[model samples]
Target: MSRVLVTGAASGLGEALSAAFEARGDEVLRTDVSYERGFETGASAPSSTSGGYRLDITSDDDWAAALAHVESTWGGLDVLVNNAGVAGGGRLDVATMDEWQWITEINLFGAVRGTRTFVPMFKRQRSGRIVNTASLAGLVHPAGMASYNASKAAVVALTETTGHELAAYGVTAHVVCPSYFRTSLMSSLRGADTALAEVMSKLVDESPVSADDIAAAVLEGLDRGDELIVPDQAARDAHALKQTDRATYDVVMRAQAVKLEEGAR
Candidate 1:
């Protein structure tokens, strides 16, 4: 069985992926910033932090320690899923630089740290897979998601670069760009942000797919040797729309901004 380490494995897409790998008899090592509050598990309240599996993606020391743990326990790693992410809603006028830093630290740099820490190990192994969980926002930018858009976009770029470099060496890399799913990512956004949350929730509610659907897409992408794995129709369409008919996509995005402005008012 493949040995896999999934960041943010306690909840959402990460949780689903962990289960999927485990079901295949893969050795799954789960890590998150904190397990005490079940933020890792999608619970809204803070609880006591669980030992051993706790990993703050922002910390290099934490990365080293986790790598050490994997080396000591699993002997090696086969897959690294940089899946930890957070959501927040704010534009330039309202969002603080601190907020931007926080999101990038987790969303962008978190993945960076993981890639940097693992690339050498994978290189040594000469066979590995890096699956990064970016977002549709990376391709289809929208208002109230500036930080998220920027961060995930960087993740996409990073994974793409890694793929270009690693493919020659038999290492595989793929970026997972998913649209809204029936996960707690919307609820996990900073502040209440309920109006936007409700908007996202409604979209997912009306959609035909859930986390499991996206997980299946992820595995399919792996099987196909796909570079950019857009898991949902929304993401696939938006990505194509952005590239093919950008003017229409821009107009639609502007309409979304107007709705958000009116809601804030």
Candidate 2:
């Protein structure tokens, strides 16, 4: 059993992962921006095996404190899952500067900081895994999701680079590029610009996957030491499109954009 640290563990994929790891007898440290009432209601943070804490992934000081706490208590961390992210919708031209900055700060920079902080710890142990949560958007350009797609694409690139850099230290990195999963992620998208929110709603209605499936894919990828894990059929297809032909890929994406625009109307 591994000592695992998962960010964004309060809900969605992060919560699912924490539960799955704990069920498998791993010592799991779950952290998020806030604690769910269910976990906090009369449930004391565990001392030995399972635990939870509040963590703001955007804050470097918060990241430092959380890592220090985990290292002090667990002695070492065997797995680090950077799963915290925010969704940004709408066309690039219409997206506000604040929106772009916010998404990049958390979705991209958060992963960067997590990898930078725990890499040395993993190197010391010389046996560890880093799982970065990217998305199918990272592999393909999706209409009206420029910020989200760009941030995840950065994660994919970072994971590939870090995987090679950490290989000599006996550490491996896995990038999870999952398709749309049924979760609060969709609801969260509602917080985006009004027009974009409507578009996101239709996309969510069309997607056919769940957060649990994504959680399973993550574990499977780690077990197999796979660099890229596309959790669902849609994600696999998206990745394949990129492999097939650049011109064909562009044509497909453009068709998708037209479809989304027509649907929104």
Local distance difference test scores for all models: 0.81, 0.80
Candidate closest to the true structure, highest TM-score: 2
| RMSD each, Å | 5.1, 3.1
For model 2, the run of ten residues with the poorest summed lDDT: 39-48
In model 1, the clashing pairs are 36-47, 36-48, 37-47
Q: How do the predictions measure up, each by TM-score?
A: 0.88, 0.90
Report the C-alpha lDDT of model 2 over 1-265, residue by residue, as the tens digit: 8888898887889988888788779888788888543233324433224456767788787778766776766678899999988777677666788888888988999999999988888999998999999888898877878888899999999999998998999999999888877767764552345676776666666767778778887888778879998888888987887888878988887887787667656
Candidate 2 differs from the real structure by a C-alpha RMSD in angstroms, to one decimal, of: 3.1
